[model samples]
Target: MTESAEVECVVVGAGAVGLAVARALARAGREVVVLERAGAIGTGISARNSEVIHGGIYYPGGSLKARLCVEGRRMLYTYLDRHGLPHRRCGKLIVANDAAQEAELTRLAERGRANGVEGLTFLTSAEARALEPALRCTSALSSPETGILDAHGFMLSLQGEIEDAGGAIALGSPLIRAEASGRGFALHVGGAAPMRLNARVLVNSAGLSAPAVAARTEGLAPEHVPQAHYAKGNYFSLTGAAPFSRLIYPIPEAAGLGVHLTLDLGGQARFGPDVEWIDPLSTDEIDYAVDARRGDGFYAAIRSYWPALPDGALQPAYAGVRPKLGGPAAASDFVISGPEAHGLAGLVNLFGIESPGLTASLAIADEVAARLSEAA
Candidate 1:
């Protein structure tokens, strides 16, 4: 029998949340170890998506999504500034194309206000277009806090912090399964040499495979975990030139931001993230290839607000899958289940972390740290 490797905490998955957990635990003087399935950290959904740091504007007040997003949004900008990370506090404008949509926009503002997000302003169409001369809108709400950052740079900064705090991140060390042994847990890792990780705490921030990982651990009840659904958003980038200075969006639908337009730190414009439900098929079977025909619907949606947009300029860019917990068009909350929820010990499973996950990552880490501390 192989001997066990001891650690204070073992965080499976080195995505944004996982790395954040490790960094927090290590910063708190806990001996932390991170195991990543990919050859590198942040290679999964962390590296994917629009890299937008969302302002807390969407969820109900007092919800985890609302509280964590607002807190994390503020902390992220500070983190970026501290690390010299590439970012832009480029704001976003949620548009109301017509009178009917204006009510939804108002509701969103109320939602944001309820969540304690300040400076969310309702603007008339003229006021909205004055800021973005190319923009044509009936009404708009400006979220000054919304922004974008170089995701890779941000993640690299996080890795540096984790390592500097005397924590270790092992890439390609996938957690095969886990079983409880005494007060700690034993984890089986997929590698040439089988690893026996004995840790006081286990963090399941495995993103897409979170539920599956939780199911793998011994003594964890299956009914306690929900099935993980893959929500894929396909992006179609605009060809050359800029359309607007800020990120533009229609009212958010349940699954995603709709076919909204989001720009990078650069002034280039790209539209996308049309929501599609991914079935439980092989990863290879679920294609990330963009469908050019999909842009026909996109053109209609964008031109509703920007009427001057020329046709045939839209092009296929990239597609990303969001690990979702709910069905299409269903506004959902972030699920960070701890021992209290499942009556388990030393386990934290993060499920249905979509959208503002990039914004709420730091606050998520704080929640995890508090839970682990309580467990201890």
Candidate 2:
């Protein structure tokens, strides 16, 4: 016989967003339990990729990404300061390689301003080069608010908040299936200690496996779950000293922010996250290995803005897959499906939470909390 338990709330996935959502729900007086498939927290999407806190520039105005990123960026800085977490407001520059691309920079600046991002400045080729002497660009859009942070540390802080508030994080516990049970959800969790849980509130913030989780939800209609797509991004670390002090980016590409340079808190610079769309596969089957041959393309992309980039400086770093809703050419907004959309009480599902997720986590938590409250 499987052991059965009960909880006031259950949050699936222990990534940054899930932890944040659990923190919000727990702090709001809800008895929350977070389920993580991995043995440790933040080992998935939250663990990989550039830890840059976006400045709400790339997303469309009024979208969840835009609003939550701007709001969460502010909230994140404050939370980091209060908790004494490690972070840096090192800023970034979105550079244009030629005059034609300069127009796109203007459009981005305008969009950034419309999204309420402060400290945006347009820079000429000379002005941009003055800031980063190694940079080569026709023009650039400077985002002083963009920065990098300790992602794992931030997630740890969120976990601390949840646990301090009397919530529990069940590591190695994956929700195998969920069904609607009297005004709540019946969750079958799998791991070393398999058990059944009856939860008054259910939040599926499962990151890459969100769609799969939703599909297992018995009461959620099929149409409510969107098809999942994966876009793998590969990063390459610089072999020698980094020439630029700040983050350097090229004009946006089809599925990613182009091969860009981002520094860790320790000042080690790495470039990458070039878009590589692979066949749709389960998260378990998706490859996270970085291909060394891909560096051939990275050299050309990097040298477009940093002409001094050496041939052998690029080394295989790591790779992360974005949980996407669309394919190579199409982009989608962060989907926070709630009771209103699917008519499921006390349940919320987050889908396609890609870039800016770490930056927008707190704000997304608040939104999720609000939706649950309204459902209640």
Best by lDDT: 2
Candidate 1, residue 6: the lDDT equals 88
The residue pairs found clashing in candidate 2 are: none
Per-prediction TM-score: 0.97, 0.99
Off by over 4 Å in 1: 1-3, 282-285
Candidate 2 regions with alpha-carbon error over 4 angstroms: none
TM accuracy, model 1 = 0.97
- lDDT per residue, candidate 1, 241-277, as tens digits? 8778899989877677678888887777888788778
For candidate 1, the clash count comes to 1
Q: What RMSD, rounded to one decimal, does every model reach?
A: 1.5, 0.8
Q: How good is model 2 by TM-score?
A: 0.99
